[model samples]
Target: MVCINCKLFSQLNKSVDEQKQKIEDMSGLMEEMGKEEFISVFTEELFDALSKMIEEKKLSMENAILLLKRIGYLKTLKRIHYFGFEKISLSERIEKMIINEEEKKEEKNEKLLVGLCECYLLFYSRVPSSEFLSICVPCLLKAALKKEESEKAQKEVEMALLALSNIYMWTNVPKELYLSEIKEVIQYHQEHHNLTHLAYQSVWAFFTDRMFFEKSLEEVGVNELHLVREAVRELEELTKNVIWMREKKDERGKETNEELLLIRWFMTMKIYLRHCQLQNEEFVGLFNSIVQMFRAAKDNFRKISNECMYIFLVAKGNLSIEIEDLLNGGVVDVALEEMQQPTLGYKMMCYNLEIINSISWQLKGKKKDEKEEAKRKATKRKVLEKMEEKGYEDDIFCFNEILDILNEVNFYDEALSLDISDYFVNV
Candidate 1:
C-alpha cells in the first residue's frame, strides 16, 4: 500500500517536473521572464495536470482531492467565471453519487472522480448553461459529517460548497441555494478538525458569492459578523500551537513541518485579513497578537516573517508610517541584504528578494500632493529599476492600485473597512 502511495505521488511529481521544463522554455521565449510569467505558467500546468490526473484516477483519494482544490485555485487565478457550478450534468452526477453512496464510506470516494475529465472538458468549453448554478451540492456535507477522519472527503465537501457558491454568484441563482449551503459548510468546518483553512476560504466565497447577502443579510439578521469573529479565534489558536510556533526557533531547532505550518498560517491569516474584514473586538485582539508575534520571532521564520508583516500592514491600514518604519527600519532591508549575500542560499535569495520587492511596492508612497508624491514616486521607480537591473521584476503590478490603497488608508481599522466595503475594489 505504501509503495502504491509513493508511486501515485510520483505521478504528480513527474507532472510537476514536466511542467517546470515547459515553463522554462516559455520563460526563455518570452521577452519578460518575471514572477507573473512564472505564476501564470505554473498555474496553467498545475491545473491542467490536475484535470488530467482526475481523469486518469491515478492518484489516491487524498491526492485526487488536493488536485480538485488546485483546479479550483488555478481557475481562481485566471479569474475564470463559474467553474464547477456551470457543469450541471456533472454537478448532478456528483450530487447523486453522494446521495447514492450515503452509507458506503470507503466505497463512494473510491471512484467519486471517474468522470472528472468529462466534467473538465465541459467546464473548459464554457458551453455549460447557467442553470447548473441551481444544483444543491451540500450532499457531500451529509457524507462528511459522518466520517470525521476523512480529510479527503472533507475537502471535497468544501469544494462542492465552493462550486455552489460560484454558480449562485455567477448566474444569479436564487440566494436560497447559496445561503443555506454556505451556512452549512461554515458550520461543518467550524466543528470539524483539520479543516480550518477550507472554512476560511469559504467565508470569502460566501461574501463574494453574488455580493453575498448584502441586502438580505441585513434584513434576515444573519450575522456573518460573528462568524468572522469565530474564524479569528480559530486562526489565532492555529498560529499559537506549539507545532506552529516551532518555526520561531533557530535553524537547528526548527522542523520542516513547523516551517510549513508557518507558511500555511501566513497564507490563512492573509486570507482572513483580505476577505473577512471582520471588525469585532476578538479580531482586533488577534490581529494585535499576531503583530507582536512577528516582532518577537527568530531568524528561521525570515521569509514568512516578512509575509506576516505585510499582512499586518494590510490588516492595520497603516501603511503610511507603519510600513515605512518596518521596511526602512532595517528589519526587511537587512534581512533581504543578508539573503542576497554570496554565502547564503542563492535560490532562497532570489525568492526572498521577490517577496521583499512586493512588500516595498505595497509600502511605496502615493500622495496626491504633487511635489511630494512626484518625489516619492520617482524614488520608488528608481528603487524598482535598480532591482530590475539585477534581474528581478516579479512583483510588478500593472497598475498602482496597491500603492493607492496603502496611501488611502493609514491604520488597521481603516484597512479592515476597505476590504469589507468593496471600496477600492480589485476589479
Candidate 2:
C-alpha cells in the first residue's frame, strides 16, 4: 500500500513539473517570435496537428480528455490571446471543422463530442458561436438525456453536462438558443435518475445568475422555489463527510480528474447561491455542506488545487453569507498557510493572483458598521502578509490585469461575476 501511494505521488509530481517546464519553454519561444508571429504559427500548428489526430482515429479517449483540458487551459493563456485569433482565417476553419466532425459522425464519437464542446469555448471569441450553438445545444441535450449505463457512457454524460455548464457560465448564451428547452432541462432529473451528482450540480449551475431568461424559465413552469431546495438537498448528501483531498480516479485510474470542471463548478456555485434567493432555512442547510468541504480541505493538508477553489470562491462570492461561512470554517488559516508554497500550474498561479485581487478588494468597500469596516481592512492585511511571508518577491506572477486589482478600490456591494477572460494558463 505504501509503495503504491508513493508511485502515485511521484507520478503526480512528475506531471506537474513537466507542465511547469512546458510553460517556461513556451514563454521563451513566444518572446523570441513576438506575439503576432507566435500566435499565427501556434494557431496553424494546432489545426494541422489536431486534424491528423482526428483523421487517423489516433485520438485515444485518454488523450482526448487531456486535449480538451489542454486546449481549455491554453485558451486562457495571454500569449495565445484571442484578440489576434479573430484576425486569423484558420480560426473559423478550425471551429467549423470541430462542429462538422460531430455532425457527420455515424456513432457518437464521445471523444470528438467532448473536444467539440471545449473547443467551442476556446474559439467563442473568434467563431460565430451563435449558429453552431443552435445546433450543438439540442444535440448535447439529447446526449445527456440518453439512458446509457456503462461506465464509459456515464463519463460521457458527465462531460457533456460539464461542457454545457461551462458554456453557459463563460458565455452570455443567447436566450433564444436554449430557452425552449429550459423547462425540460430543469425538470429532467425530477422524473429520471440518469444524472450523476456532479451532473445535477452542473445542470443547476447552467442557470446560475442568467437573468436574461429567468422570466422565460418561469413562464415555462419551471419552479425555482422547488429547484433551489432540491439542489441544496442533493448537495448536502454529496458533500456529507466528503473530503476534497484526492482527485477522483477515472478511466480505471488511467487519469485522475479534470480540474477545470471542478473549477467551473465552484464559479457557478458562487453565482448560483446569489441568484437562488436562498430561503432562510435552505441557506443554513446549503452552507452546512460547504462548511464541511472546508473542514475536510483543512484536515487533509489543503491540497493545492482545492485550496485554489477556497480562495477563488471566497474572493468571488458577493454576499457575506458565503464568505463568512468559508472564513469561519477555517479557509482563512489554511489558505494563508498553503499560499506560502509555490503553485503547481499556470492555472493555479492565475488563481493565486485572482485570490489576492479578489480578497484585497474587500478592503475598499464603504463603511457600513465600524466593526465590519475594520474587519475588512484586517482581511486585506492578512492576505498581504501571507503574500510577502515567503520573502523573495519580484512580480513572479506577471498578470498585469490581475495585480492591478490590489491597488484599485471598488465597492463589493452586489455579487459580481469576475471577468474570467483576464485569467491565463501557461503564459
Candidate 3:
C-alpha cells in the first residue's frame, strides 16, 4: 500500500491530466484575448505542457495531440507573425520535441511526430528563416519516407507530405535532391488515395513556385517539365477516382474532396498553360476534361464556380477561338446563374462579372478584325443573337445590380473605378 513506485505512478498520472486540462482551458481563453495578448500570456504554459508530455512516458502520442489540437495550436501558428512573442524560443522547443520523438526506441510515435511537424510547418510559414528550413526540410523528408504498414503510419505520412508542401511553398530548396523522394512516395503509394493526393499537391507546389516558373530548365538545373509530366499523370489518375466517387449513389461529404482535387487540377493546368504555351495536346486534353467536368457538375456549381472563373481568366488572350466558343457555349449561362444567387459572396460575384467582361471584350475584338463592314456587322449580329439566346442581356443588367450592391456596401470607389472595358487585356 505504501509502495514508492506505485505512489510515483499515481502522481505522474495526476500531473499529466492537469496538463491536458490546462491545454483544454487555453482554448476558451484564446477566444477572449487578442492573438498577441494570447500568445504572450499562454506561450510559456503551452510550451511547458508540451515539454512535460514529451518528458514523461505516461501519455500516449494520440492523447497529447488531442490536447494540443484542443488548444488550436495549428491555427495560432498561422498568425504567429502578428505577435511579439519569442518565436525562436518556441521553435527551439518544437525542434527538441521532434528530435526526442525521433530518438525513441518504442513504437514509431507517429502521432507525436506528425504533431511536431505540424507545429514546424506553421512556424515556418510565418518566419521562413534559413535556420528553420535547414532543420525542417530533412526532418520532414525523413518522416515522409519512413515505412510503416499500419493505418496510423499512413496518417503520419499524409501529414508529413502536407508539411513538406507548406515548407516548399515559401522556400527554394534543391529540387534534384527532394523532388524524387516526394515522387517516390506518390508512385509507391498510388493506391492510398489520400497519400497520393497530398503527394501530388506537394509536387504541384514545388514546380509552381514563381522562381521555378520564371526560370529556364538550364538555369534551374533541373528538368522540371519532366516532373510536370509526371504530376499530370498522377492528377489524371486522381481525377478518375473522383469521378468514380461521384458516381456512387450514397456518397455524402464528397464535395470538399472533389473541390480540393478540382482546385489542384486547375492549378496544375494553370502551370502548364503558362509554361508550355498551351500547345501540348496533353494540356489541351486536360483543359477539355475540366470544361466537361464543369458542364456535367450541375449540383456542385458553388464549390467550383470560383475555380471556373480563374480558368476563364487564364484562357483570355491565349486562345481566341476557344474563348469565343466557351463564351457562347453556356459558360455565360453558368456565370449569370451563379451571380444571381442571393447566397453568393461579393468577391465571387465580382469574379463572375470579370469572366463575362473578359469574354465580351475578346468577342468584341474579334468582331473588329472582320475586314468587310457587312461581315463585321453580320458577326456582331450573330454574337448578339447568341448572347440573347444565352441571356447575356440579363447578365449586363446584373452587372449594374452588382454595382448597386457594391455602392450600398460602401465599396463605391471600387464600383466607380471598375472597368469592364479592355478586361481581356493582360495585367
Candidate 4:
C-alpha cells in the first residue's frame, strides 16, 4: 500500500509538471488570441490528455487540484468539461484531506483547503458528493467568517466565497452556514475592486438557487409573494450594477467580461422569475429588460438573446400572458428577425421555432370568434411570409421540421418543466 501510494504521488507530480509547462508555453499564444479563442482551439487536446491520465488512474485528486491551481480557475473550469473530472473519486479524496486537516488542526493549510473547495466547485454540475460538501461547506464558511483584517485574509475570504458560490450552484447551502457570511461577501464585493465580479457571481448563485430561495422564505416565515418582491428588488440592484459596467466604454469595442457578467445577471433573474410569482408590473419590467438586452446585444452573443427569448416564451405559456402583451413587446417581430439570420445555428433555429409555436398556440387559445381566428391564421402566415421574404426559404426544411415538432410537443410547457440544469447548458 505504501509503495502504491508513493508511485501514485510520483506520477501525479509528473502530470502536474507537464500541465504547468503546457500552460506556460500557451501563455504567449493566449495573449495573441483571446483566452476564449485559445481555450476553444486547445480544449480538445487538453481534455484528451487529462482524460487519458484520469482513465489510467495516474492522476490523484490532490495532483489534479494542484494542476488546476497552476492553470488558474477559469481555464481549469473550461478544461474540466473535456477532462470528465466528474467521473473521478475527487470527493472521497477531498473528504480524506479534510479529515487530515482536522487531525492536524494546529497546522492548517488554508491554501490546500481552498484548492479542494475550488476543485469541488469545478465539478459542481455533477452534484458533488454529500460527504465532501458536508465537510467542505462548513470549513469554507468558517474560513470566510474569520475576522482577519489583513490582505491575505481578505484574499482567502474571497476564495472561500467563490467556492461557496460554486457550491450553491448545485446544492442548497444551509442558511446557518451562510446567512451571516453572505452579507459580508456582498459588502466585500461592493468595496473591493479586484475581485468584485467573483463576489457578485457568488452572491448571484446563492440567491438564485431554488433551495436557498425557498428555504430563506420558509425561515423568515414570510409569504412567498412578499419575499419574492424583496428578492426582485435586490436582483434589480445587482442588474443595475452589471448594466452600469456594460455601459462603460472599453478600447476593445466589445467588453467580454462585462457582457458575460450581464448574461449571468440575466440568467439569475430568469431563475427568480420562473420560481416566484411576481406583480404584473414587475413581470413586465423584467420581460422588457430581457427584450431590450436581446435587441442591444451583438450578434456574437446570440445565446443571451436566445435565453431571453426562451424565458419570454416560457412566461407567456405558464403565466397566461396575452398575445397582445407579447406583440406589444415586439417579441414576434424579434423572433422572425432572428430566424431570418443566415448564420443562426441548428440549436437556435430549433429555439426560434419553439418561440413561434408558443405564440401561435397562445393566439389559437385566445381566438373566440372568426375574426380572432382569422387574425391567428394571418399571424402564422405572416411569420412564413417574413421568412420567405428574408430568403430563409432555403432552410424551408428546418421550418417544416419545426412545424412537426410543434404538432408533437408543446415547447413552452416542455421548457418550463425542465430542470434549471437543462436551461443553463445552452446558456
- Report the Cα lDDT for candidate 4: 0.53
The clash count for each model shown is 7, 0, 0, 0
**lDDT per residue as tens, model 2, 1-427:** 3342232222222244453454344444333333344344455445454445545544433343344344444343322435344444444555666667667757756556556655554445543466667766665666676577677777666666655655544455677656545446557667666667667666666666354336344323224435535655664555443445654433332211233333444555556544433323344444454445545544343452454354345434545343443344444444444445554334443344454445545545657899877766665555455446643133433334443453243222322224432221111
Q: Please, what is the TM-score per model?
A: 0.42, 0.48, 0.57, 0.57
Stretches of candidate 2 off by over 4 Å are 1-46, 52-91, 97-128, 168-170, 180-182, 212-222, 225-227, 230-263, 276-280, 299-427
Instruction: Judging by lDDT against the true structure, name the best candidate.
Output: 4
Q: Model 3: residues >4 Å from true position, as ranges?
A: 1-48, 52-89, 96-118, 145-153, 186-196, 210-333, 336-345, 363-386, 397-427
The C-alpha lDDT values of all candidates are 0.42, 0.48, 0.52, 0.53
Better of 1 and 2 by TM-score: 2
Report per-prediction Cα RMSD to one decimal.
Answer: 14.5, 13.9, 9.3, 10.3
- Per-residue lDDT for 69 in model 2? 46
lDDT: worst 10-residue window of model 3: 1-10
Rank ordering of all candidates by lDDT, starting from the highest: 4, 3, 2, 1
User: Model 1, 209: alpha-carbon shift in Å?
Assistant: 5.9
Instruction: Give, for candidate 4, the lowest lDDT window spanning 10 residues.
Output: 418-427
